[model samples]
Target chain A: MSLGEFELIGRYFRSMELGNAGGSEHVTLGIGDDAALISMAPDKQLVVSTDTVVLGTHFPPDYIPANLAYRALAAAVSDLAAMGARPLSFTLALTLPEVDETWLQSFAQGLTDAARDHRISLIGGDTTRGPLNINVTVLGEVRPRNVVRRGDAQPGDLLCVGGPLGDGGGGLAVVLGESMPSSVSDAARDYLFQRFWRPLAQCELGLELAGVASAGLDVSDGLIADARHLAEASGVALHIRLADLPCSAALQAWPEAQRMEWMLGGGDDYVLLFTLPVASIRCLEVWASQGFDVTVIGEAVVGSGIWLDDGQELKEKVQPAGYQHFQRKSND
Target chain B: MSLGEFELIGRYFRSMELGNAGGSEHVTLGIGDDAALISMAPDKQLVVSTDTVVLGTHFPPDYIPANLAYRALAAAVSDLAAMGARPLSFTLALTLPEVDETWLQSFAQGLTDAARDHRISLIGGDTTRGPLNINVTVLGEVRPRNVVRRGDAQPGDLLCVGGPLGDGGGGLAVVLGESMPSSVSDAARDYLFQRFWRPLAQCELGLELAGVASAGLDVSDGLIADARHLAEASGVALHIRLADLPCSAALQAWPEAQRMEWMLGGGDDYVLLFTLPVASIRCLEVWASQGFDVTVIGEAVVGSGIWLDDGQELKEKVQPAGYQHFQRKSND
Candidate 1:
């Protein structure tokens, strides 16, 4: 059955009682009012970020609602994670052509699960009738001194990734009708699909790297384009080794040349790319023990842009074109 | 020239430096980063609200970009005003089919004007290529005890409005090609057009009524529908007098029956409708001297639901329908 705006919000969005995870203290009031009220602790600074995902542009037209919700929320939360912020709460503004009860239920469930995982509440939002679009604004908290920024990367700092990448790109390719490698196992294929559907924002790793990392940001619009951003922001050159690029077993099963394209230029891999001093990396060994696969991939140098390498030979400079919204095509 | 997402944001949105006011104390970081950082004082609670306006649905397809931005921001900020919250910061997510430089300039100017008026900074946001849509998320602050809510109206409380209503409705009629009333003065027509183009949020008045008002909400979806919401939330009946509905001379230029319909059920007024004890309203007399036309219009009763009156005769119950987004039709 189709639901009206009020009933849809009440039946699906409002029932995600996130207060159970000790998060209600942050929310003085939630949905069903003009606005939601929240409180920030004296010692914490609030981090705010917003992201928009439009159907047919951001994903395929027939995408599942649940996965769309999860991916959109994850993408927004990734910005907060880059700032070393812990999730506090989020608001979603959704524009839909029509209300499908089953779709709403699935989307709400995915949003609920994601919010619960990050210990944040869906405090307030608005739903309107239009073409399908989701805009999420996430509020997070970080200690003032521990906030990480992209402009603080130092020359000689080692570049590291919080985890593997390119699985999401591979899955996207498959979803767009590109056949998966026959050699890829069923479990690996499933892993890639899950990675595409539910990208894990590196919040925990970011929090751990708070005061430790020199600079950081989540990989969204391809590694090469994002690396150029970091280099420009930090006033340094980032040199990456293609051999050191991290990938999953599923990605490795793909054609060798195609794997490089996905790993270097593909978008939507929400893993954290950060910089740390060589000595500091050794001191931050606890993350590995905690099951985080922090891998050193490159280093920052005293220069301007981004340079690529294939272990033996220094490759050509990578283009800075990323997944820009208005640009017709950007390496994605 | 058409602009890319980054160029558009950099040229138009980033230059609004709201930190010039006393507000910068709450913002540890502003735009141009992964996330914007904000801090709230220990004594204040944060209030958050979000709203979305899409082309052709919220406004006409050929709406001017500047007025669209202004009205959209005003509508969103009205929610914060309803909660008696002071503006802190805001995030905007805009989706556009194409980037028109002239449109962006006008929209940015309107956004800057509004942000300057409210002294709130544009913290962080996203821009995407899609059908034209604008989503704004506002953050504001209020003292813990002084927070105004919807369910706190007492049986003996007096209902009041911050200012006149229905001018926006009249203006909207003109915008939709309903010929202006033949008797309407040129000045009155201009006033109505201005009201529709730039609805004001009664933030100052709401802040003044912080601890004084028992319950409150901004009149967006007309007085009838919104008052019903208040009554349902407070578990008390609200009796509104038709003759007492504060309206502008511009609205009076329309037909008597049309004016009443617009006053009772028209949307986009963005004025505060609040309830307070009879005695507490007297303490608010100073606001009138300060140029706020605070007028008493109704009272809360012991029972539930809403009742309508025309001074001596009881009028038919006003239908509790307004400009609901997903509903097929309302007054708008």
Candidate 2:
């Protein structure tokens, strides 16, 4: 017999723990009894964030359900990454048009694997009939060390990105008819595809950079728009050294125009865009031995508006400034 | 000329703050920020919970969109009520099919009203196109004081519900074609309909009964199902008194069979269902004089299963229970 939703969660979704809580902090609890108990911490503060991914909006139609599930968790985890909050747990609200057993098995397996990897529990959520949608709420804790905000960037702070800019957008291009991954070579294409589908939440980087990173946000809405947001919020001008933006081997192999488009306008890369004090650039190098390094792209200056240093008066109309639904479909 | 989603949120959704964070020594920063910063007393901990409501699944299809928004937030707030936690703040993930200008205005108005009424801030969330679904993650504070669990009920404890039962379900009867609201006329019918749509989260009662109530939960599913859950978790049996089950004036006037169905099977009444120490009932009565009242409907015993005092047997004819959406529709 096929297991019920409750039974499915009971067997696979329980027992995972995230945050220092590890299911012990008393702040949050997962499925088991009638209700979960949470014991608030004394010195630490709590940060809560939520995100939802509809089937065709956040992901491609051809995207596998398991991959979609992992990406859903990652999307919310990305919020924690932005807040420098150690995730305690997450509740998933999954709505599906149908309960295909095989699809559910794959989806639950992916959800369980991702939760275990992040140590976040599937506390409690609901399932219902609807078009495919997954809403995830992540509970996290922050220390006084820092809960980074987008408004904290100073005029002279160095603007940087934790990782690459637009592989997801490029991978999406490959998913649609506009581009071919084979153009970037098989292995590199595979790398970009996976990165686009199951982007990692840079939790460790967020925690480590909390004190040093002055202003930060997760790069869900293409780099240009998100960076514009950072600058607008911080009341500063952001200049991008098109040469300084990170890229994947696949993107490097693309034509200069195409590669730059992905970096500037692609969404769902799940990387961190942050700024740090100009003096901290030296500290960044000292921490480079930890296998993490960010290239300083520019500095925050007094003013607003983004500058593209590619020596072009225009570049594909700035990809219409992030993917807004009902505005238009993406052609990247 | 109407504001876009981002503009609407920026202009109106900002400046939302829960009482002053500076007034409390534990709160570091209140609202108008990415996340509210809070410090817990060395002895106190935080409780986090989430709840979701869909347009058609949790509420009637024809209910006003604004009322649905209000009720969705309340459903989630009720989780704090069950945990005996003080409401801090909540984040909302609202999914809608199309951006109806009038609908968005009404929905936001309802959301703001509910947040203001509850003294909780709308921290941050996402907006997207899909079936209408509202998911809220509520964060509250609690002491080590036995953070009530469904498993903690003792044999001699009194099964108490914070308020009357069945009004919500009876209201649903009026909503669906099942029955009419003959009991409560006109505006009162609208009131019952609103209550069924968005019942008040019993945060006050939860806080008052914290140390005294051994086990507690919010009754989203009917009394029988939720009671069965409490009994199973507490490792005891429950004998519910039909005579003692608190009935509202609206429900009391309904036909006996209809009321029974509504009270025992209808869900979405966010009242606190808990078992209190018999001795604490007196203290509870004292608080009742102040505002909140506790009604004893049954007793927990050293056995398993649920029994109704009506002297009739409950036979399980159907395998499935509340809020089911498992099977795929043939139409789909």
Candidate 3:
């Protein structure tokens, strides 16, 4: 039951309805072409973002192709979440050295399942032979003027997080075969692994907090780096109480400095780091009543530099911060 | 002499002044963060597209990194051209085994130059260490109702081309070192080589033909495969005269079958294929009046199928068309 390119597309890719996000009635044409064209909501605007995950860099060589498909879409869609936008449509351009039916089936399942869950439709893209890579370009819907941005933080706004950090970052060590403490229980292991392996984009949270939050960004590099972006963009300062930094139970047994290292510098945390008025804490609680939780980590202050609870005046974190490819020097 | 990712991006990618297209005014936030956001045009819709080019698949390995960058951007931009859209922004996700300063500079230069020409800003994207691959996503602007699709070809429309074809296909053979004819004089060699190396995207013609052409698409795969798509989508028959296939003068000395193969099945021909009414042909002469050359290659008839002159059928050309990665069945 092997299929060539056309047949493979016909059998697995085309049959799946990709543009059913209640916007299909508006889509003149969907997939199966050189490109796709669709209209945005009449009252809303369109938001677009793209992310590419390359094998061995974004994931280990032994990473499952199926999960790769899912994670690639997740990482790209997370940008829309950071902007307080609703998932709409995505185009996937996947490259491979060769094709394997089983691998294709699993990969397609991940790609389509995520699309369905997010109410997005497959649009248009290209396929070619090369090293394995998945680039997902996603289009989302946002209110005409309610989208949040990194530059909107105010002096009195409290800095908050959508969930626990360092899970994805710490989980990478496990993937790379680095040994850590045993207090990171098996339940903690599964929790962090799932966080690292299949991160759920906080689209709902983003939209919910759109008007309430002054500034926001997805934590991909690390807490320190992303926190700095928010501060720099808003022309304010961020003061993170080191003791308030959220961590999974996995870090309880590690030395304080090492645990702080993972919490501060471990990249891959896709959680949303944002700032809002202290009054919004009640609104956030109401959001948590709806099943989405948020943690208050610190606050935006009337200052010019980032700070830690230890009173360590952090003038600079690092230049050209975070996970970079063309930086000439590797972050890790 | 040493520059980091931020400095590299500032010196090259951000050099494009997106203010020409009005995207800069709407960029609530630009590059240098989790993602960049652009405000949707008030009256026009947003068009998004993604394309991937592998080292040995789209371009020969010997192709310089800069040209490869320019060529990939050109290929993707051709899609927006088919839709008659205004270029807005692009995201480049580059994957490589290792960061080569020379390669990065050249690739960035090509991308920077192309973007400057079209005023397409480089938005935010990922950079990862892995196999060499580039995935580019482009967003463009179009009137809410003016998009052209393959499904819009009319039964009695005149099938027209934006420009000459087969030049790119023949150019690829030279790049691949598979077929270099001695008869193709040295004077024309550079033209053919450049054509194959950096084929232009028909964005201007596409935007100009929005209301003039009935349907449209770019020739990434061969003409036959794409023509079949146009015929099937429109539910009409396309009748192309085999003797009427266009070619560059350098390729004129090639054998008839070789010429046909290049014209029909040679992928990477980024020319725009479109349909217009015989009555509308006179109107398109406005392009010629504007100093742009247009070619008429075929006509659409009532029925579903694409045929060549001499009464040959498309099925006779082979349905397992174009070059697939698995065509070579490489296990590695």
Candidate 4:
């Protein structure tokens, strides 16, 4: 019989352990048991989130297995970053049409690399036979009082982003051959592609913002939509200065309208959006000096919905619609 | 937009909390946030397991939504029982083809009931748009020293089962219209069907067996196959008595050959199969007296593989192949 689920896991996934960041010390028992045993840190509350990536729905079908694995892990772990939590471990439920040795090796390598970099261990998971689908449940921990929450945003708090926007969406558009800027440089195109294929979680910046920021969330479902999520949760309005959006050099090559669309509607950016008082400007300057792309985009106000403004005379009430699943076909 | 992923989750899944499972005491923050926060119990190691059920692979597409939800949760939580852990909380990643309110309501109701009965809170999960898939990551807790592992069996250990098996397979056969026994009563047929749709996790029994049993695992794939797994894990042989195999009244109504096949090869029973020392006979008696269907069906030996024996004189080596996904098309 071709490798059964158990044998496939044993061959490819069982030995992928965590290194650095306390190498598997948190795990009492790993795979090969009914369930993995995890030792939780005292004085820390466990933060848990799950995300599923369906083939053809989440990523392009032509993507390599390694890129797929990396993107999937990055997206899921990004939620922990939003919560300002330290990565602990994760479980993966993988369903595949068939077993491919080369694909498994590449995927495992990508997953192991990401897990190690994030200081998370592969505690336990399930492998089954079906249409390709990957569900990752990531576990992290943070001090109860220090956890950044979307509902904690306060009026007059400055809204900031840890990095640039629209790169992932631009990359996807270029990859799909639907929208391409004729004047875009080859380097810009390559950079955008890498942004989509392997986005950073901005976890360290999130940790830095834990006590400084009032509220935060990861920008996965586009800036406008995710900002609206924070606004609704915090029961406040977000007035965003469209001119202040930090767009990457690659994304800026697109037409103004196209660039705006990608900035507001792009998904998979995986950047942290947080709100903090003006007193945190010193912290922002420090981060900027340390080569982090931090930008103040707007401020929380005493109302609901989003208000968009330009540095010039242009001002408008923009509809907060982003890449919502079931409503949109793709991320952009 | 017809139900964005977030709205669907808020409408259908977010409210499905466990009332009896400490009423979210374990969850410091449930749902809504970027990630859920869970408070871990002290002096206990957490047990985590993930299982994904895909449409047209794990179950029949025509099955009711409620039954599907119940079976999925039961199967995932059964792993915790095998590990002798108390159910704490679970996260579900559900991907559906369309937004059907009736279907979501029914599924959520079934899932809620199961979670309440199992004492597991619905901490957090993800709802997305895609083909029908349900991935549940169950978290539980057990004392490290009392964990029932598959590798702890010893020679001369008495192998036992907590309850009868084969009803689920018979029920599945009936549901698929491949089996009809004239001698089976209506109640028998109903019992078999219920067994398949809502198998118990045997958590209470597993907890009781933790400190008393030498080794244990949930019987998911057929008895012969699961026994072989235990044997391999423990580096020993498991000798099972064919006549001693526990069969429910509903399953016994089938022909002798069919009954034997279902008992030995059927899957999804979710009963605990464990080994204990001969000195633990008193513990077995105590459990049996308290209405647990504990039965010593075999013994472990100082070798590998599984041996089947009939009370008379028949002895044979049984091939351990049962419910291997991709290898088998369906339960039958």
Q: How much is the lDDT of residue A55 in candidate 1?
A: 67
Listed in order, each prediction's TM-score against the native is 0.93, 0.89, 0.88, 0.93
Candidate 3 backbone collisions, by pair: A18-A121
lDDT of 3 by residue, A72-121 (tens): 77878888889888877788787766667788788888877677666677
Of the true interface contacts, each candidate retains a share of 0.68, 0.40, 0.50, 0.66
State the DockQ, from 0 to 1, for candidate 4: 0.54
Candidate 1, residues A162-183: lDDT per residue as tens digits?
Answer: 8787776787876665676689
Q: Which sections of candidate 3 miss by over 4 Å? A: A1-3, A19-26, A57-62, A174-184, A249-258, A278-282, A314-332, B1-11, B17-26, B57-60, B176-183, B253-257, B316-332
**For each candidate, what's the DockQ?**
0.56, 0.39, 0.42, 0.54
CA lDDT scores, all candidates in order: 0.79, 0.69, 0.73, 0.80
Identify the candidate with maximal DockQ. Answer: 1
In candidate 1, position A180 carries an lDDT of 68
Tens-digit per-residue lDDT, B1-332, candidate 3? 12344455345555543433434555655666555667776677777788777766445657888788888788788888888887777878777676676878788878876675566777766666667778888888889577877888887798877777778777877777675667877766777778886888888888887777888888766687678778888888999976766777777767766766777777577888999977786866688898765778889988778877877666733543443311332111
Write model 4 residue lDDT over B1-332, tens digit each, in one string: 23354576576777776444533777888888889988876678888999888776335658888888888898998999999998888998887777788898899988987887787888888776667788999988888888999999999999999899777678778676665868888898888878888887999998898888999999887676678778889999888888888889787778877777677767678899999998887998799788889889989988787777842222233233433322332211
- Mark the regions of model 1 whose C-alpha exceeds 4 Å error after superposition: A1-4, A19-22, A310-332, B1-5, B18-22, B310-332
lDDT of 2 at A115: 74
Give the range of the ten consecutive residues with the poorest summed lDDT in model 1 chain B: B323-332
TM-score of model 1's chain A: 0.91
Q: In terms of lDDT, which candidate is stronger, 2 or 3? A: 3
Ranking by lDDT: 4, 1, 3, 2
Interface RMSD of 3: 5.3
